[model samples]
Target: MSVFNQPRRRIVVLIILGLAMVLIARLSYLQIVEKKYQRLADANAVTKKIVYPSRGIIFDRKNRSILGNDILYDLVVTPAAVKNIDTSYLCEILEINKEEFIKRIGDAVKRNGRVRPSVFAGLLSAATFSRLQESMYLFQAGFELVQRPIRSYPYKAAANILGYIGEISPGMLKTDKYSDYQSGDYIGLTGLEKTYEDVLMGQRGTRYIIKDNLNRPQGALENGDFDTAAIAGKNLRLSLDIELQVLGEELMRNKIGSIVAIDPSTGGILAMVSGPVFDPNLLTGSSRTKNVSKLFVDPTEPFLNRGIQATYQPGSAMKPLTAIVALDEGLITPDFGFPCHGGYTSCKFIKCLHSEAGHAANLRAAMAHSCNSYFLHLYRMEVDDRKWGGVKKGHAKWKEYMSRFGLGHRLGIDIPGESPGIVADTTVLNKRYNGNWNSCSELYVGIGQGQVAVTPLQMANAMCLIANKGSYFLPHLVESIDLDSSDLLKKFKERHTVAKISDTAYHSVIYGMEDVIEHGTGRGAQMNGIAVCGKTGTAQNRGIVNGKAVDLKDHSVFVAFAPRDNPKIAIAVIVENAGTGATFAVPIANLMMEKYLRDTLPLSKQPIMKRMLETTTIQLSKLETSKIDSLNATTGMLTSEAILKKYFH
Candidate 1:
């Protein structure tokens, strides 16, 4: 002290004070501001259990539970905590060898760090769970049974619309959409489950318990003061009619197509059925892995939701739209006549079913008869009109009308992976024909052929607008969520108008469709005491086999709206390779409409329903035989023909 100068002494004292202050500040930050350290400290002395709440329940329009959840147990393990224990006893219970146990433990440590827990085995059978529950004390903290909810379908229908849930992938865990989810968590992969996942997924909670030196739970920490209780997920209410759904599935049992029926008044989907559907229960429980593997490999593609996924040429079903567009454009009147000599001669020689004197005498007659020549001439005249300037411009104008009618684009239904069927415009035409194409070059489009294609959803939605006389609500599945109308429900409730077409033009089209069911080609759809308006379609297309075009059977299609005055239901049906629309599509659609309107089919129609149930139109290619066999062998599914005999015959 005596050797030190006064200024140097002051500087040294200040440095000591500064160091003391910094040390105090860091100590305060660690002790008061940071909780991770406290959590880690508690982790060493306490047991943390994740509490999973029950997933949301899905109900139909009648307040019936369509999709529900059941409790399942999974064997979980923590590698770091797996200390001195009877490894062989655990192996015996799990039915595994010592080598497999070592390998699985190593895999668990590698997948996640030694400190974190992992799923050693999942979806334990009830018998295994019961056996393990009685002797869980032996495994203590390292191994535990975790309770989770798995989906259960009460009716075993609407598999396509409901979709399935799967584990979160490593890639998905990194994304912000799934940031809240962790490894081994489940998420909806498709359909309504995917659409309403945010509302359907339950919140997770944590329970902390004090533990002894042996990692055995003593009691709740601080009398459960810091523990949060698990809250069950919100439930969802749908507009789907479960009874109608069951019927539709039965009717479409042996076919390879889809049917969609909508309440035109509210735009609520009544029934959406895709054939070759599997029981949704197959995707849950212990057999889930094997069933999912088999389903993913099946040749018929039961996973494909044909209602909104499959696209087909509208065929004669599009004649009414052509008539409406032409009438709106002032190109044709209600009484406009055409002298079609069994074919269209102006451009392509497309044959017509009706060549009588007055068959094409007016819009109603032409549409009633599904006269191809009449609609083709209408398209040519509308496209070649000077008002649109040129063929390209005229064609673009026609496409605009088609777009307004929800053609050539997605109608925005509440589902995933929807297809916008083909609707060619000027740009597409120019690219295909090098800008030298004229209206006559694509005349087949007028008859809903050539470049025109549509989904069963779109076809049904179009019928909705036509049924409303000008406007329609967007077709949707969910009606409300937990008795509350969400923004999605609000959007579906809004009515959208297609165009400013006169009501008279719609009446003309409606009259023709009515005649189709009453006395024209769609007479098979006739019903007593009901004014049904319908149209038939036989779509021609070629399939590809080894890069060659093969002549495939024509697709049968039908579109209809029943009780014509105040329309109740609008429906569209398609049966692939089923020949004439009157043969397959008409009967199915009419029966569906009858069920929706009358709540049941009469005794007389029972025979017709049986015929539809036992019939099959699926023609598997040689290339798909092996794949189909593999699926049948591995999945225990019946053959395409045998499925009908097993369930209905």
Candidate 2:
């Protein structure tokens, strides 16, 4: 029994010895083989570091210039390692206020993890960085520069079109919908920036590094093996000519309206100008807070992209659609006639513009004369007359025809924030009047008055459809996106047909428009050797001219494409409160067309861009109603007696 117990004790001692050996081997492995854990044990002696890759550049499609930048700089701060940092002297060197210096360092302590460094300030330009780099010892331990990029826009005036960038909002960050974006990242706020954000923003790259006890990066401990190389954003070649765009903006200075031009075949925007355009540069860098706020509060609404955002009554521009509908409905032949014996009075209170006398006219002659009576007659015959089928058939048919031509809905342009022009539906009318829908509603819609509204872009797009013989591409600002070997132009190269009107019907409409610019209302747009085709529209408004409600003025509007056949460009011009379309809008449209077509023509011969500019300046200067000492001399009409009775009574 003693011998057995001795063996058991020996066996137990041997087992204890084996267990001790295994424990020693495990400790050796953890200390030697797993050096990472050993190093982490002495966390106070080492620091973990991350390297941010340089951002990519954004270039214009033409390769003419750089539109964005990946500017890099150092952001310095003190950490646990920098125990002897002279807070007062450091503040002096960094040019920060004493209280700010204390608060920033406190924030760094809260945000920084253990020995991790924090960025107190950033974006030191190269020159300042060079001067500071020589005095590195002054900052000591925790001082370091973390490289990062700044958002940039090279073309300053193109802010409305190019848009500005800002930090991603808290709401945007919380959603996680944009998987690519992280916290404290810049995002496109408006314009092309917002429209093509996904394409512009590339993947971010990161690198790991080891730091010394002083928090200075010792080396690329991982040598960028895990880093992603930043990819440059694809270049966007816009259809806009920089020179023409600048000239267009200068032309529309101080005015309240928009100028829209497009390539008739492709719907490539040539120039889109709105008056009082703010400089996009104002929204960049550290200065944006003050400037952007003032701009936002300004009464002029400088931020509004009037070209595709604002809608107005098309006025006589809708005449083309009206005529097309009338012809298609078989309500009238090309020679359909209506006598405007002054004006068409439907009721005591409702009267057409031609109330004085009527003119003998067919469709062609009616368009030439802008005969309101003729359109009113067509609306009554084709729409209001129950014999032809009343509201539902007429309204539905009109809507179908307009929709086919891409009205009443977003034209689906590549740009963001596009406004779908207002189309008065019978349902909307029924809801509004509780089924008291009468000839009154149909009549106003026929004449492009009342609730019918269209953006300048929609109007220009419609005109381009007409100019292209009833087919069009969606209006797109970006002509192509080329990055690496990928050419995105081919994807957008497909021709989209907006409508399919017959060749004969198209020709008939084209001839009428051609006549408008030549022997009719749009004579203001005619130029030598340029067979311009266009129409004029005047949207009437009732407002307080002085202290009384009166017919204030008409918005002048023009839609035209030049050289008639094989048209190069089409344009729509609208000048708010400018009395006549032919007088105000046509001249501007003519100028734009002339400049675009004859851009290479000798400076002396390039009268179009210049004339367009001068005319806009002259018109805007005349907006001051108080300057009109003798209103009757220019207006040739007195205030309505009803207005006087309403106020002076």
Q: Candidates' lDDT values, in order?
A: 0.84, 0.68
Candidate 1 lDDT? 0.84
RMSD of 1: 4.4
- After TM-score superposition, the amount by which residue 607's alpha carbon in candidate 2 deviates from its true location, in angstroms, is 7.8
Give the candidate number with the greatest TM-score.
1
How far in Å is the alpha carbon of 419 misplaced in model 1?
Answer: 0.5
RMSD of each: 4.4, 9.7
Question: Could you tell me how far off, in angstroms, the CA of residue 148 lies in candidate 1 after the best superposition?
Answer: 0.6
Tens digit per residue, CA lDDT, model 2, 270-347: 878876555555665545665677667655566788888988898988887777766766667776677566666654
Model 1 segments beyond 4 Å from truth? Answer: 1-40, 483-486, 620-649
TM-score of 1: 0.91
Q: In model 1, what lDDT does residue 82 have? A: 92
TM-score, one value per model: 0.91, 0.79
